[model samples]
Target: MRILFRLVAAVATVLVGQTAVAEPLTLIIARAVAVPDSVSGQAMLSLKLTPDSGKAFARFTGANVGNIVDLSINGAVVTSPRIAEPIRGGEIMVSGTFKPGEVERIAERISAGDAKVEVDVKSE
Candidate 1:
């Protein structure tokens, strides 16, 4: 099963002074892995996007600095992180209070493309 992810680019419009009519961009995940945190030794989920999605993400973040980007999974909002700067890299690390086993399971599911992920950039 392939997970479909949508990135709403509302902040892009605000940055460029354009109308908020841009369609959401779809981002594809290349892979996900559970790795141990270097400092805390806790499990962490790492997500790598496909090349095209990475470029799209970089552009979106570059245009939306200081904006909040909401991340959703399975139609439920999970995290809303502020874009401090452009993320040119294709990798993202998700760290939380998840147990080791839980993180592993989540990583496996994501890597197998069994979850739907969405990112929404809202204008402040």
Candidate 2:
């Protein structure tokens, strides 16, 4: 019975490995800013984009105005919302259902300048 179980597990692992893997989520961010919430005065983190990336995002949004874009962190999809308009200025406000530690982790990465978004001041 032990040998049979091992054989089954091996076959299952092989099959799983043969299956296709989904592409990881990618984000275009220039920097992240931590600020206070307006209502509750809690801490809030905002994602910003660099100038070049902002131009690219504007083009993409223009092309896919009605399409949904996935907002992710660490390859996990946090929200998939439809694009309402062209995203100019390259700033994204993250507000939604976020696990307590999840936002903290994101903030830590952003503060460390290790997140996918480039850390830079927006050129006005």
Candidate 3:
């Protein structure tokens, strides 16, 4: 009975220690995507980019698309394309989060369709 109590106490101590440590979440690009449009005479493909920040992690979801190597998310390229595609789907949802302790809030704008859209990203 005494040995059993000791074992339980040791386990509880370990669990408490683990919880005391604050582990921040990290962001990673899971995949690349492509998007096509009728902007030009040809089926022009421009990635539907979503610039996100301020969270511990961010998400990027989409199908492999253009030769465009990376998605410049609020001035930072957090994702890269595996291959190029003309007509793609669900690529705009590619998710990415700011690196733990690396994300900040920034005031910026980006070209969306034809208008400059405002954006907020964690400053470096």
Per-residue alpha-carbon lDDT of model 1 for 1-124, expressed as tens digits? Answer: 1232222355555567853322345558898888899998988778899999999878877877777877666665556788799898888887767744987887677778888766777555
Q: Write down the lDDT that model 1 would get.
A: 0.73
Each candidate: RMSD: 11.5, 13.1, 15.1
Between candidates 1 and 2, the one scoring higher on lDDT is 1
Q: In model 3, which regions exceed 4 Å deviation?
A: 1-68, 89-91, 96-124
Task: Tell me how candidate 3 scores on lDDT.
Answer: 0.33
Model 1 lDDT, residue 33, Cα:
85
Predicted candidate 3 versus true structure: per-residue lDDT over 12-60, tens digit per residue? 9988775222222222222323322334222222333333321212221
Please identify model 2 stretches exceeding 4 Å from their true place.
1-28, 39-44, 117-124
Candidate 1 C-alpha RMSD relative to the actual structure: 11.5
* Model 2 C-alpha lDDT per residue in residues 4-118, reported as the tens digit of each score: 9999999999988762322332446666766667986555668777777677666666655666666656555555667688778877776666656566778778667676532
Error of 2 at 92 (Å): 0.7
Which residue window of length 10 is worst by lDDT in model 2? 115-124
Best-matching candidate per lDDT: 1
State candidate 1's TM-score: 0.73
Give the C-alpha miss distance for residue 10 in model 1, angstroms.
22
Give the clashing pairs for model 1: none
Taking all chains together, each candidate's TM-score versus the true structure is: 0.73, 0.60, 0.24
